[model samples]
Target: MNKKTVKSFRPISWPTKGASAKTGKWRTMRPVIDKEKCIACRICYIYCPEATITPEIEIDYEYCKGCGVCAHECPKKAISMENEVH
Candidate 1:
């Protein structure tokens, strides 16, 4: 009779939750922006590491993680992280 055993596998650098560090800080989903506050200054668009914010266009929620970075960066503070009205 013959028998075989399967070997267990594990990743060297396991990418778990919030694995990527943002400037020595860990981060997960991030925010886009609210065009109402955006005055074409392009501040958020310039500082965005992920290049998620749109230029002269409303936020593209498809890529936005809603981290509130853009809201904090806004010069006018026009952006805010508001939860669903419901």
Candidate 2:
């Protein structure tokens, strides 16, 4: 009996430095975590598409796209999307 073999494909190139991709500049709004209300539940961190939410519950504005996923998913409503000043 003869068996057929399949070849796997991988990405030709990968991002070199960071995940930012300079998306922050396009965002009109930004997420602000209310530390006073935050429960440290990590919901925001998990929902951040850009992975901009840090382990210490800080949002890295440099990469955040203002998608509002973190604010929408926060159970405690600790995250809010505010208009970007600049």
Mind giving the per-residue lDDT tens digits that candidate 2 earns over 1-86?
A: 22233233633334554643677787898888888999999978887877888878988787788999999999999888899976
Q: In model 2, which range of ten residues has the least summed lDDT?
A: 1-10
Model 1: lDDT of residue 52: 56
Q: Model 2 off-target regions past 4 Å?
A: 1-13, 17-20
TM-score of 1: 0.50
Candidate 2 positional error at 77, Å: 0.6
| TM-scores for the candidates | 0.50, 0.76
The per-model lDDT (C-alpha) reads: 0.56, 0.80
User: Residue 82 of candidate 1: its Cα lDDT?
Assistant: 60
Model 1 stretches astray by more than 4 angstroms: 1-37, 84-86
